[model samples]
Target: MSQPTSRPTTATRVYLARLKGTAVFDPLGDQVGRVHDVVVVMRLKGAPRAVGLVVEVTGKRRVFVPLTRVTSIDAGAVITTGRLNIRRFEQRPTETLVVGELLDRQVTFRDDSGTATVKDVAMEQQRNRDWHVTKLFVRRAARGGLMGRRGEGLVVDIEDVTGLAVNPAHQGATALLATLEDLKPADLADVLHDLPDTRRLEVAAGLPDDRLADVLEELGEDDRVSIVSGLDVERAADVLEAMEPDDAADLVSELPDAKAAELLERMEPEDAKDVRRLLAYEHLTAGGLMTTEPVILPPEATIATALAHARRQDVTPALAAMLFIVRPPLETPTGRLLGVIHLQRALREPPHELIGAILDKDVEHLLPDDDIGKVTRLLATYNLTALPVVDEDRRLLGAVSVDDVLDNLLPDDWRGADEEITDQAMTRTAHG
Candidate 1:
């Protein structure tokens, strides 16, 4: 409730700070109400800032004070000289706007080509020690069909939106994107389906690829294809390259053949081949989730050498949790399938020991033709970071990382300015 020392830039600037219980006073110096909320009218270019103050005027009689006439503020109340009687102000809107009333409601705005919905607001504490709303988090619009039934979609950020208003009377209940903190992925997916296409895409582009992939997977094949189609090929390739090969393959395979080929053409050769191979199988099969980047190593390699190989590879740190040991000879080999070794355990052993000697001989793996459900269960049951998919002959084909599995399960809100979890970390100023 502390005020900033600087003069505010505009009327809307006054609404940037939270004002849940500020006092309201009239001309005779009599306190008329307690402010319960500050409604912000977000404006873009060429628009005026309008703010509505929700105030509790008397016992059970609530009024909205237009912020245009507010003159001053001190420790006790806000000074205003608006002409409306308390009852008349209350009757003007017919729709009550309170902080609590607006809590989970989806506020929409017109953007580049469609509408965006308020996903979250980004605020931070300044060096001078006042809090202010800096950005309005919006879910980018979704495309394809009405009621989330079909088509490709993409999510990205739409910057500098400045207006916020209530939906017209005929729009029914406002549907909002959930930021309730702990909602399950399933529930979050339902919320994603309710958002307009533009809002969904904006939110999607902001999140990390892993989380976005999880949400897309949860949306089912058609929705996933639609969402990916909205992204440029480069963006799509970046996402595909980041995802586990199998999952990436599954998404691309679901796209129209032309689009899928175009996306593949944009990816790195090794990645393109892996995805193309995965596309040859039914989506529900294990091949759909198999990656081609298993941690292959030679039988002659010592623990020291294997460790060095993992560091040199582009595989994520998570994938290094378990390192795959293959024959030393790349073309043809004569060693048995040495058990997989936990990268941590391998690191602790004496440097001179060959990797095969330290491996846990009992290896559990799946054939490429196996069901995806089996692969998921193995990942969950053993709490693995990367699972190796093999051929019927026990030769390694590729690997699936835990991150890939998650992408298949959530609505991609990839981190955006609005989804920013970290506000500036503020330290209290010492008294001078």
Candidate 2:
């Protein structure tokens, strides 16, 4: 058959649902077959680009047809570049078939709302002149659905779909991770740890640096080591850089000396310095547990400024609960600690009031060499979530949060009980 004589002048957008089972024709106006599925190349961080279509040809055998050969899609018919190969379709590792793998899948939206069934996917032409799945059509059960009525339907941008709950029959880690894109790093880490080694590594390969760093922090030491070492040297260094200095140092400390040094050399000079500083302290001491990234501001800053800083998305709830006031040369390993202001005080104080005025000077602090026992005792005595650590000259080095202290004080298997603890907490909250 020759190429189709008529073709659409401009690219058109169409839903995947409408395209499936559509009749496909060659250039000579001959009926070839029907589209069995759309094939897309799954990417680690962006929309999956359309590679081609799977068409059910003679003898009901399916074959791959590259999108480059497609001329147009209109009125339930697809026009092709006129040539067709007669080989049976078999999906490669990098490819996902929309009809077979993605259709009818359950997905969680960006807002963490209840799951919705995927009804269709909106495809658009990209800058590269290739078609890509850019949005999703979802259906949610509504009030009327209880009586056999149709439910609400929505068209959402692809980015808004945070997670996919893959059918167990699909059984690909990449597909599972694609749907789990919306999970918190900690939650994702928990899931990753439970996966088999090869699958875990495959999923880890797709996570961005910041997300990987957060997951690494939540993972057990052995799992962290495994994931980090599995990544290429440059990527490993980037992931470490994205992590808190203390956490990065802890992970690096567990690695072989030669490998650790190589990764350190590959890291940014400033980030590597922070990690090296934490590595200088014994793991059981105050310095070892402290995070060098605590929220610290000069004494002259106002309560409003302090509050704004606390509200930043990057600041964890525990770290945002207090602000560290420091004197001149306000940098990491900052000059003498002036005072601290708890969030509670910041809220009640006038907006323009300087933090120095309401500083909590009687705060209990830690020396770098203080043992974990002493750190725990001080935190308990003061009822504080965090305690700053300083050197002999009173230069603020870092602050250890209660969670970190607990992690150290608890038995080695404490992490294994985390899910049970979380479940119990949820149960208690439900009852009350």
Candidate 3:
């Protein structure tokens, strides 16, 4: 089936249009507190644009800032120079949940079966998309009431749920917990990566290819390509387009030349061209590792203007940090590479200043000829999510993200580790 054309963008404005919620963050880069509220200045006409977030710094106080200021988003914390005066932020009725706040508290899921004790909660975000969740990651089963015993293993999916119970003192919020099987393709990819391959593909077939593409980037390279190769060309193309250009390139490069060509033919022309370019390089070089797509803008563009451009492009949350400020002749321009800035840094600063002012001095740069090992080492040491790859002319060709590196390095390893243990158990059971 042909995929729909709606490209999901990581605009806080879009998110605000749907459901508004607290943005949980371990703001210090150490997983801790959740964002209790986000305050945005909507356009007087309609369609609100997120101006800033009301972040509750863990164990400290609440603060707010424009969404444009977000820098680097990671599993641990959101890095930013945007500091808020504790007294200035508009306080909400709700208190932000901290690490110890919900300990031993009751948590509930949309899946009925009732409340369970919170073991620990995990936070996750879509790269380049700033939405966050405070998931009750693990639980001790509820017993004595509507929910049965503690050992039954909490059921994951139910069409709907009627009731929930949690301590008002702790104030943990309930979210619909989708089963590993029931999760959307992207979420399933994360769940599957944590499981075995037999289980991964078995579950993957239930999801649409587009969603599968989102998760594929998260899987080990070997497993990711194996699953894509198993798919028909059309489905493969849909998944590939759904991925970052760097990721799409890595996956496409793995296919037989003819098969890869056929899949590329079905993709959007620009996306197709990007994959082909990366394919031309040895899979380990800076050229091979970089993505052709970067959220680029003219160097003179104001932060407000950049925000508008980002909304139009549907740039994901992760890519927002690497927003490339290029001096345009659009095709290519002269000048050494300007420093890079985080999204948070961009937003919190005065809207009028040129982005060039805040660029990082320690920017990681790579020549197209640089080896893949050099690429990964830079990522490891600098703890960077992305690196810009430029030609000898210093013309930006693309960027390489950490996800792309892991996908290239690991190669289906995540699944096999889980698979082997599962297989051994199955064999023992069969023999017995």
Candidate of highest lDDT: 2
TM-score, candidate 1, is: 0.42
**Model 3 per-residue lDDT tens digits across residues 279-377:** 888866777777776666667778776665455323554556567766564332224456566677777888888777876756777877787677777
Query: Candidates' lDDT values, in order?
Result: 0.55, 0.77, 0.53
Query: What is the TM-score of each predicted model, taking all chains together?
Result: 0.42, 0.60, 0.50
User: Mind giving the per-residue lDDT tens digits that candidate 2 earns over 208-291?
Assistant: 555688899888888889998999887788778778788999999999999999999988787889999999999978899999
Off by over 4 Å in 1: 1-194, 205-223, 300-320, 328-337, 351-353, 372-387, 400-432
Give the better candidate number (2 or 3) by TM-score: 2
Model 2 lowest lDDT segment of ten: 1-10
TM-score winner between 1 and 2, please give it: 2
State how far residue 344 of model 3 sits from its true place (Å): 5.0
Q: Counting only residues 3 or more apart in sequence or on different chains, how many pairs clash (N, Cα, C under 3 Å) in candidate 3?
A: 23
Off by over 4 Å in 2: 1-173, 418-432
